[model samples]
Target: MPSDAYRDIASLPPALRFLAGGGEATKLILERDWSDHPLGPPEAWPDILKTTLSTVFNSPESMILAWGDQAQTFFFNETYFPLLGPRLGWAMGAPFQVVWADAWQQAKPIVEDAFAGRSRHFIDLPWKLDTDRGKADTWFSFSYSRVLSPAGDVAGLFIFTNETTERVLADAALRESQEQLRLVNATLEAQVAERTADRNRLWQMSTDLMLIAAFDGTIEAVNPAWMLTLGWTEQALIGKPLFSLIHPDDLSHTIDGADEIAAGQNFARFENRYRHADSSYRDIAWTAGPGDGKIIAVGRDVTEEKIAAEALAAAEDQLRQAQKMEAVGQLTGGLAHDFNNLLTGMMGNLELLQLRIARGRLDDAERFVIAAQAAGRRAAALTQRLLAFSRRQTLDPRATDINCLIFGMEDLLRRTVGPTTDIDVISGAGLWVAMIDATQFESAILNLCINARDAMPHGGRITIETANKWLDDRAARERDLAPGQYLSICVTDTGTGMTPETISRAFEPFFTTKPIGQGTGLGLSMIYGFARQSNGQVQIHSELGHGTTICLYLPRYAGDALMPEEEEAIATAEAASGETILVVDDEATIRHLIDEVLEEQGYTVIGAGDGAAALKVMQSGARIDLLITDVGLPGGMNGRQVADAARMLQPGLRILFITGYAENAAVGNGNLEPGMELLTKPFTMFGLTAKVAEMMKYVGG
Candidate 1:
């Protein structure tokens, strides 16, 4: 070390140079070759060097300069003048801790490390300083590094520092923003998952058959309801063409629907047939629409609706046919009565001639006598059948044990059903009795047996059973029946069962599933009419390839009569009387026949072609005893009105009304009152005679 290096140290400010004692200052000059003279004491040198270093670094207060082998305080720059309070120019030979007493405890470790050859780095250390200016909060970035002497040994320490508080706050704000963004993203993801789960639950819980099909018509997915509705497993439907499940006739439409869906069109509603797992076709109503990459279809089976529609149509047709038949019956009944009158006259005249010939007054022959009688019998039989069809024939109702009735007719039933079919009776002991017309019941049973026989052409078993049933109010409401005890006569057959279409129309008049001439299509219709007329109901159940069960529900007889043999016959004879009768009819032959029959029955008769003529005749003061008039009379006054007016003239007057067209709107349709008897047209001469006599007796009474 030369005196030249020592000279540079001595050139430092006096405050720093004074820190070096005399021996230290001399040692520094000798080691670093500073100015040769004994320049100053070591303390003075430190003070001078501290002032010089601060001036060189352009920092006033808080400046430090240290060199190798020195733990002493070296500098207090001109900036320290304000901080040192009235001792601004004081010598800088104080210890480092004493010089920075407020921060010395905190800075000691850093200072020590630096003197030991560790480089010091800046750090933000918080502190409060008491000064003449004021007490203030300050943050400092203090750095310390080792200084070297001329021999390269540790000599002193150097420190550089800065104040930094604003930078630290800015970093905290950035971290908060990042945390907020993470929360938003997490919430969005959670919402998406919840929505997906909700959608899956809704799809599973739905009851309608639902399916998702690909654009190519292959089934991509099906809900549990699909399997439940169609009776198909999930695996059976997957990857299968959706149209494959449609009925053959509906396959083309199904394909078209898929094409429309793929083209982004939605079908709001459509009806078609779908094949059930059991190979039957079910009528289905469905809505299909486009969805994400697929077609979604929802549907319900409407087979019952289709069946009910068919049944309604058939019922309407049967009603129309029944009306027609009733019209014909009226015509026939009138004709029979008129014809019988002509026969009565002819037979009376013929008997008179025969008696005259036997008394030897011959002329004309006996040939006319036989022909008239034969013709009369034939007309009577025709009238009877018409009456049967109309359900207007008199019934001989009896409390008949069905078991005996069926057993007695077993031979007849077997003969009627043919040799191939087997008849089985399963009537329970102590079976209930039904109040019914035995002949009609026999006819109905025979007709049913024949129908069953026809259904089983290849041979089958027919089971006839009779049982008592109590229909409750709830059940009655469901079935549209009157709640009461009923006698249920069931005829079941193991035969070729009818489809819904066939079964629905099975009871319609002239609507037959059998080949032409094989059936008249009147058997079931007749049975239905008979049941309804007898205050009963008929229900038929049949399924294709299964069997049929036809049940007849009749109100149980609550009266006393028990046996068919003990039952009394319906009265056919009319009351005897001789009262004036006025017969009004548009048909001349009918009018004349009625006049002749009534006159033969010992009642005075007057005829009229129309209601006006009858009224005019009555107004003319002819003492008409009974007004027997036709419902469909010419002019404004109908039979009912005519009877009303006639009764006004003659209060408490008895009327025997007649009609060829009973459905005449002017007649206020349905049956006439018991006091006003109705004689449907095309009746037998005997029927007219009896009815007229009955009315006369009623008036007399």
Candidate 2:
């Protein structure tokens, strides 16, 4: 019936035959009744109009054409769909004045110039239109050109438009951001000036070998300690190349440390041998930092201490080896008992599932399948907990309101702590937003409450409070954190407290005080690692009688936070035609599984087992829409190296990093660039598909 509506399309003149393949626009043009239009029937249309229509229909950019002496009639292509609103239903072959009535006044002069044979271009031309969502403001950058007949007479107008509303708004936002950055720079300059004065006051009083050197390692000045300790007068040390006095073997490390400081990283503590006035090598421990275009350094002569340290280290190594063996044996027993139990559930169900399939017992297989899946999920969770303890787990950080997140978890917290533990929540007012992984934060809080409950062993009170804090230099140093604005979530318990020894070892992995069979000893350690990985700190306050309080301190996020209602609207990914993906993994099972999943979702997948093989595929110049790679790879190259090389070849390639843990210093330590995303191992098929869909939204945009 639909084909019958356009049955006469085949009878059109050869000049109009170009309209045959322009998708929905072509179908509408062919089926429309052109008899009453001023342009008349397609058979009578001019060759210029026909050819121009063909071009308009095939163009990938938004285009509209107006023909006839008065430029009354109009036509557009599929690319112009977005510009159409409620008028789209009657847009095809509609009068130009009726279709764009809202913008006609603003467009009239440009349209007239085009009809008079002069082309015009406009940028950020503003307009207002009534749409399904009511009135909306829009901006467009476009060009209007005249279409002429063979006689060279001005005939019609052709317009190409690109919406500039988003760009216009973004430009305004960027100006605001730049102003804010200028203010921040001013504040930093003042802070630096103040710090410099403090350092100047300490320069003469300090009893260390303090010196100022040029970036190129030329010593400029030295304090009195340098002359007293190294037998070199201040005049002798000054004007000398600092590195020339170092032992040959220490040159490379010293140079590397200098290079790092030049590249803007704070110089780490360093040690090297420096020659004394008598040509004897002195083992000097050094600390250095960049200061006002020079390197400010302090060296402590550690020759005596170094010898004592070497002897102590040798003895400590043997003690550590014996302790490690004992700890490993205990760890093995605990892990073996738990893992074996979990494996039994999984393997037993899988075996039963196979037996049922062989006996054709389809109905009985569902239970076994579910049981096996449950066991597998538990094992995956256990593995994640272990990785969390080492801060090696992948984290998906988002800007979040800590108060809102905790409010949402109130019900779960109460239910988790049980009826005996009275829960109290005190959310901080005017709390600054934080960037964190919400799921892991919730898990950490839950673990703290569980530990508190176990401490009481009876009815107790758990108070959770939040507050904004500014940690100055002294406070920050005590917490082993940098000075800054931080928000803290503190949990306190009215229960039996920990001894100083217990408190000190609380965050050590597998060092729990609970009975061996009752605890895995990873809970507190996981929380500690998670906090550190998130650029935050966790502190414990407890004594033998007083209640214990544990607080997690996270740095404040400066940017606008994405609230619940502001989540990105990402459409489910259904692969477009010819979308190809390349999957690289060392494990055959993982590679095949990814290949099958993507293939089922209508994607063409290419598989490679190692980084070298994947690079070869990239070099082959095949079209790759997405690359899914495991971070840990064999054959001398890892996933990050492959991705970096692939980006060089194809800068816009989207990457999905799949990993068991943060293994290759793990995906830039969770700082993935734009167009890149990460997925942890043991992910469900649904999670894999969903993440892929979310990332695909950035493709070609």
Best by TM-score: 2
Q: Which residue pairs in candidate 2 have backbone atoms (N, alpha carbon, C) closer than 3 angstroms, thus clashing?
A: none
TM-score for each predicted model, relative to the true structure: 0.40, 0.55
The models' CA-based lDDT, in order, is 0.67, 0.82
lDDT (10s digit) by residue, model 1, range 337-358: 6556667766876787678678
Give the number of the best model, judged by lDDT: 2
lDDT of 2 at 100: 88
- Residue 212 deviation, candidate 1, in Å? 38
What does candidate 2's lDDT look like per residue over 111-213, in tens digits?
8887776788889988897765467777899999988889987677888988887788667545644543443245656634643564556655676788777
